[model samples]
Target: MFTCLCLISKNVFKRRNKRTEFEILERYKIVLEEGFENGLIWEFYHLRGDKGQEVCRIYTQLGNVDWHRQNQWPEIYNFFIKNMLQLEENFLMVKEVVKEELRG
Candidate 1:
């Protein structure tokens, strides 16, 4: 199992006289400097698309589709949520990269 962690942010934009749109923002990916068997790699990006509809797109190289839909994803989701919450708590001055050091 390749434990790759990716950060996905979905943004919905609404403006008068314009159709609503959604954007998936991916920031960066986190990976170990040296390969580690149990290590995780996370990637973040910014996505833009039509709003009010589910946006399903492939995240190439992130994981297998079956794996995301069937196994291990819930736990992965929880991990991402937890990390996000922690990051939000310090949104003012903390850099996302600091999470690596804090994990140590």
Candidate 2:
């Protein structure tokens, strides 16, 4: 019984990981389709599947500063832009990871 439980848990873990990877890839595709450089950010907040629920959020950078508020700090805007770039890179990496996992 213990061995069966362990196997079951392992399978569940693997499934969850695969689901997460797929979700990340899907989100990445959506982000790209939405165009990261078009002054619009694609954010995925809630991801649900058979394995469970996961949250994937990606913020795209806007080249214009027209949206900046008068009271907003310069550092905050810089950080936001940096984070957006990181998210875009992360999505690319995650897509490769998912492809490898699927191949294996």
Candidate 3:
């Protein structure tokens, strides 16, 4: 059997008040990339919907998704967990700021 890790984390933006997603995404990328020591860099992969417009939340992976069931699952999971924790720590830096922005 094989394993496919999916949906590590995501963000959905409403683009209210005519705010552009491109600007928002770029800002977010910087915010996330800051202190994002994870080796796996999650990008905007359009799995479905219009190629230019996505109506659903953006999905990203924290580790290698495809793996052989008995080959390296443990190692991959451990590494992913480490990165996830790091991501959390980094996010904590700007979590309140982001929340306040969202409330606007």
Candidate 4:
């Protein structure tokens, strides 16, 4: 029984890791589609499945800045606003808690 429990836990962890990798790839594609080019950074945290974060830095050929207050990429900006928590400037961090209950 103990061995069986260990196997089950291992399988669960493996599945979770696979899911995390897939999610990161899918979202990175979305970022590319939104015109993110050089300086794109992808980070994945080992938090709960429902908790995550995203940060974007704007550049106009000069390079990354401390902050950018304009919605230069409205589509991307709106997407972030709808999906993550918007902080000052163009930085966005995913909310730790989901606002709406997901349906099965």
Each prediction's whole-model lDDT (CA):
0.34, 0.44, 0.46, 0.30
Clashes of 2: 0
Clashes of each: 14, 0, 0, 0
Ranking of candidates on TM-score, top first: 3, 2, 1, 4
Order of the predicted models by lDDT, top scorer first: 3, 2, 1, 4
For candidate 3, the C-alpha RMSD (Å) to the true structure equals: 6.1
lDDT of 3 at 13: 42
Query: Distance (Å) between predicted and true CA of 33, model 4?
Result: 4.4
lDDT, candidate 2, 56-92, per-residue tens: 4333433434435656456456656665555555556
Candidate 3, residues 41-80: lDDT per residue as tens digits?
Answer: 4444334343444332322253444575557778767666
TM-score of each: 0.26, 0.31, 0.49, 0.22
Q: Candidate 1, residues 1-104: lDDT per residue as tens digits?
A: 33222232332122321111111111221222122233333322234443543222212232443454657678656555654443344332434554543344
Question: In model 1, what is the error at residue 98, expressed in angstroms?
Answer: 18
Top of the candidates by TM-score: 3
- Residue runs of model 3 more than 4 Å from their true location after superposition: 1-31, 34-45, 48-66
Better of 1 and 3 by TM-score: 3
Error at 102, model 2, angstroms: 4.3
Error in Å for residue 7 of model 2: 31
Q: Which consecutive 10 residues in model 1 have the weakest lDDT in total?
A: 17-26
